[model samples]
Every structure is written in structure tokens, then in C-alpha cells.
Target: MKARASSQSKATLLAQHVRAGKVYRREDLAPYSTSVDRELRQLVDQGALHKLAQGLYYKPKKNVFGEVPPDENELLAAFLKDKNFLSFNPSVYNSLRLGTTQLYNKTVVYNHKRHGEFVLERRRYEFRMKPRFPRPHQVTPEYLLVDMLNNLDDLAEDRGSILAAAQRKLASFDRQKLQKSLEQYGSAATKRLMKRWQTAEQQGSAA
Candidate 1:
């Protein structure tokens, strides 16, 4: 009976630390209980927490409609254990008006750590390890254009047609900014492609 009471006490303490619509790893709640795993299991059984992954949990928040899902940023922060990551859908490329209209179903996270696919709370993510990526606020059309060309082979769009369209519309982008982004983020092939297009544009202008 004393053991049962102790478990309940620890559970209560852990519960106090949990916030609704927040995601947590098992270790984040370890300080509240002597046997955190046991208490976590108990919480899951009691419907106070939902297990999102092997070691991740979420506290559901209910509204008039139904339970609110944990915020994507919060979820990624918990999963990556680092806040220096950028997450976005590949569909954002379509906004560039670069002839890319196909929508991607998976979210892509570019970070210095971790690589490959992971499913978090039923949402799919393709984690790609990169040496560098722009901060959230710094992402611009120039960067997206460079990124699209960098990952051109991976995209479903017709490469020849997209390249042609981009060459035709090259004057629309800020040349200085695009060149800087290209030098920083563009792959070798993308740099070569952009250089060729710029050369052609210059020659056409001279003609």
C-alpha cells in the first residue's frame, strides 16, 4: 500500500510538470519520479499522455472540436533535441513560380545532425544533414531558387523544361542575391548551370 501511494505521489508530481499540447521525451520527465518509465506507462494507460514515438509523449489539449495536436515546431524541437533546425514542405518551391507544381507529402528538415526518414505523430519527415542552411527568417526567393536547382535531380519536374523556364526568367531575380545564394548553397552542377544561363543572358543582351 505504501508503494502504491508512493507511485501515485510521483505520478502527481510528474503530471504537474506536463503541459497540454507539449511534446516531451522520457528523460525530460525523469527528474520527477524514481521510476520514470513506470510512471510514464501509467500515465499512458490513464490517457493523460499519448505516446508519439519510442521515447516521446504528448499531453492532449481538447477544444470544442477535438484534441489539439502538438505544434510541429515543438514536436521537431523535442525530436531533434536541438532548436537549430529548419523544417518546411518541399511544396514551397512552387511559390517560386519556377514551373514546379507538384506537391510533396513529406516534410524536410535540414540540420547538422541526423539523416533519413522518420515518422513523428503520424507525419512523415525526411531529415537531411547539410553543412549549411539559411535561418528561418533568411529564407528568400533567391535561396529557394538555388535550392530547387540544387535538388533538381530529386524533383519530379522535367529538368530541361524547368531549366529553360528559369533561364528565360533569370532577369526577374536579383542577380547579386541569386549569385551569392548560389555560391553558398548551390551544388557544383547548379553553379555550372546558373553560370551558363547567366552567360547566355549576357550574350543575348549584347546581341
Candidate 2:
């Protein structure tokens, strides 16, 4: 009289939606939300899911890290899933090996609008989500770069390390990528960063 633990059809759908390197949302796992949420909560209660935020979760690391503490980046990334724009941005200052200061908190930004802050484990993510247009890529790389660059100073303590990231971004990024991105997320600042990146590229190439 009880529902089976794992329905063949439902399991297939979950595997289908899960792709390597991509964070998933409830919709992605909705096929089994009824069955899975319960089982999932069981995992969390068992300290398997390691709750990241409300309605967001991820698998534990393969290698043991003693207590299996909450992974802020994973939990934060998962929380930002289904967002208009989200990316992993690590600037020089935050790069511990780069000799810059570190934060007591793990910080992140949500470029798309979703007002208010939410608590995540030991970290408090203070973010302001701004309304944004759709982008071809869920989160364009260039946009991520600029956000890192603009916030580099606040996020990183060492100017040297920040400069290194800036140069690496300048050298590797294709500024024109922003033009195509405008088809999706057209913003004044995105446009501005694109144009600036282009000019710098031109000068760099000429030299």
C-alpha cells in the first residue's frame, strides 16, 4: 500500500536532469519531489545532504573532511541556482595563496533580482539581486569577470593580486563576447564594461 522507494521512470528523470558541473533546482528534481523530498530530508537529518539553504542541497564531498562541514560555495551556488546570472568568481584578494586578506564570511553576489538576505550555515550571504534580462548563457563569463573586477577591492585586500586577476581576465577574455550577451542581458554597465574591455584590448594588441 506504500509507494515504492525508487520508481524506474522517476529515477531516469533525475539522472537525465543532472549534468556534471551544474547546480540543480527543485524543478530539475521535481519528478521525484514528492518521493525525493522526504528521502532527501532524511539524508539531511542524517547529515548526508548537509543543508545549504532553504530548499537547496547538494551531495557531500567524496573525500572525507572530518566533520563534513557545510560547503559555503556549494550551498551558495545551489541557492543561486535558477537565478538569471550566477558564476564562480574568485578574485586575487580572496586568493589566500596570493597573500591578500581573507574574510570571516564567504561572500557572493546575485546579479539578478531577488530581494533580501538569507542565512546559510555559518556564513551570512549579503547580496542584492538586481533585475536583469535573459542571457544566452545562464551566466556569461565576461559579466562574471567584471563583477569580480569591480568588487575585487572590497573582496580582496592585496592590490597586487587583484591586478593579476585583472590582467589575466584582460588577456583571456574576449570583450566582444559581451555584444552577443547583450541579446540576452542588456545593461548599461555590461555595455560599459564591454566597451572598456574592447578599448584596452585594442591598446594592448597595438603595443
Candidate 3:
């Protein structure tokens, strides 16, 4: 009876601490109670929270429409335990006017945590552990240009057309920022592509 009462009491306290619509892991709740696992499970059954993955959970935010799905950044932030991640899709290149119409089935996250693919809430996320990200938790234009070239061979687009389009679009980018990004995050192949593109553009202008 005493143990059951303690569990109940702890669950009540935890409910106050956990924010609605916020994702949390076991570690986040450890300081609240010793029987956190059991209390968390009870909270799930009581409709106070929803279990996401094995160790992930969230308190659902409700309204007239119903419970809202977890925010992508918030969900991943809880899972990764770090907010310093860049979330983007290969298809973002399409917005660069590069004529890349290929659809990507997954979103890529560049971070310091887990590498490879994962499925969260039925959505595919590809996490890449990089030595350094272009900018913490952001995908800048210069960074996109560098990354698109770095992973050019992997994209499901016409390689020649994409390259030609990227070369054309490169002229519109901030030259200094592009050069800086290239020096910091670009691969050798990307550097080569940038060099060739710059030379061609210079020659074209001179002609």
C-alpha cells in the first residue's frame, strides 16, 4: 500500500513538471522519482502522456481538433539529447533553381549523435555524425551548395544537368561565404567542382 501510494504521489509530481507537447526521455525524468519507469508507464495509461519510442515519451497537447503530433525538432531533440543538429532534405536543392526534381524519401540530420537511418513516428530520418556542421542547427545557402556537391553522386537526379544547373546557380551565391564554407565543410570533390565552376564562369564573363 505504501509503495503504491508513493508511486501515485510521484506520478502526480511528475505530471506537474512535464510540459504539454514536450518530448522527454527517461533521463530527463530521473531526478523526479526513483520509480520513474513505472510512474511513466502509468502516466501513459492514464492519458497524461504518450510513449514515442522505447525510452521516449511526450505529454500530448490537445485542443478542439485533438492531440497534435510531436514537433520534428522537439522529437529529435529529445531523442538526440542535443539541439545542435541540422535537419534538411536532399530535395531542398530543388529550391535552388538547380532543376533537381527528384523526390527524396528521407530527411537528413547532421549532428554529433547517432549515425545511419532511423524511423520516428513513421518518418524516415537519416542521421549523419559529422566532425563539424556548417552552422549549428541550421542549413545555410552556402552550406547547402557545399553539401549538395559533396553528396552529388548520391542524389537521384540527372548528374550532368544537376551539375550544370548548380554551376549556373553558384554565381548568385555570396562568393565569400561560399569560399568560407568550402574551406570549412566541403570535401575534396566539392572543392574541385567549385574550382571548375568558378573557372568556367570567369571565362564566360571574359568572353
Candidate 4:
């Protein structure tokens, strides 16, 4: 009877610390319970928390539509345990007006750590390891343009037309910003193409 009371007390303390709509790793709630795994299991059984994956949990919030899905940013932050990752759908390239209109079903995460596909709480993510990628807020049209060319072969669009369109569109972008993005994110092929475009632009200006 004494042990049961103690267990209940621990669970109560842990419950008090949990916030709805927040994703948590097991260690984040360890301080509240001596037997965290036990309490976590209890919480799961009680429907107070949903198990997202091994060592991960979510305190769900409900509305008229039913349970709200976990926020992608919050979910990624908890899974990676780092805020430095850049996450977006390939569909974002469509905004560049470079003739890409495919809607991708997967999200890509560019970070220094973790590579390969993972499904977290029903959302699929392709984590690609990169030595450098812009911060979320720093992502610009120039950056996306360079990235599209870098991943050209992987895209389903007609490469030749896209390349032709890109060349035509290059003159409209700020040269300095485009050059900087190309330097930072462009692949060898993209760099060479951009160099040729820059040379042609310079010659056109001279003429």
C-alpha cells in the first residue's frame, strides 16, 4: 500500500510538469519521477500522453477537429535535440517560379548530423547531412535557386527546360546575392553554369 501511494505521488508530480502540445524526450521528464519509465508507461496507459517513438512522448491538445498534430518545428527540435537544422519541403522550389510544380510528400532536413529517411510520428523526413546550410530565416530566393540547380538531377522536372528558364531568369536576381548563394550552396556543375552566365552578362553589358 505504501509503495502504491509513492508511485501515485511520483506520477502526479510528473503529470504536473507536462504541458499539452509539447514534445518531450524521456530524459526531459526524468527529474520528476524516481521510476520515470514506470511513470511514463502509466501515463501512456492513462491516455495523458502519447508515445511518439522510443524515448519520445507528446502531450496532445484537442479541439473541435480532434487531436491537434504535433508542430513540425517542435517535433524536429525534440527529435534532433538541436535548433540548427533547416527543414522544408522540396515543393518550396515552386515559389522560385523556375517551372517546378511537383508537390513532394516528404520533408527534408539539412543538418550537420543524421542522414537518411526517418518517420517520426507519421511524418516522413529525409535528413541530409550538409557541411553548411543557411538558417531558417536566412533562406532566400537566391539560396533556393542555387539549391534547385544543385539538386537538379533528383528533380522530376525536365532538366533542359529548367536550365534554360534559370538562365533567362538569372539576369533579374541581384548579382551580388546570387553570387554569394552560389558560392555557399552551389555544386560544381551549378558553379560552372553560374560562371558562364556571369561572363555572358558582363559581355552583354560591355556591348
lDDT preference between candidates 2 and 4, better one? 4
Please give, for residues 123-201, the per-residue lDDT of candidate 4 as tens digits: 8999999989999999999999999999899899999989989988988887888889988989899999989988997
* Position 98, candidate 2: lDDT: 33
**Model 4, runs deviating above 4 Å:** 1-9, 203-207
C-alpha lDDT (0 to 100) for residue 107 of candidate 2? 46
Ranking by TM-score: 1, 4, 3, 2
- Over the stretch 6-117, how does candidate 3's per-residue lDDT look in tens digits? 8888899988889988898988888988788889988998999888887999899988999988899999998898888888888988777787788899999989988988
lDDT of 1 by residue, 1-207 (tens): 998998978887898999998899999998877889999988998899999988999999999999988999999888888889999898999998878899999999998888999998789999999998999998999999999888888899999988888888889999888988998999999999888888888898899
Candidate 4 lDDT score at position 190: 92
Local distance difference test, per candidate?
Answer: 0.90, 0.53, 0.86, 0.90
**Model 3: how far is 184 from its true place, Å?**
1.6
Cα deviation in Å at residue 144, candidate 4? 0.6
lDDT of 1 at 1: 100
TM-score winner: 1
Angstrom error at residue 161, model 4: 1.5
TM-score of each: 0.94, 0.42, 0.85, 0.90
Candidate 3, residue 53: the lDDT equals: 80
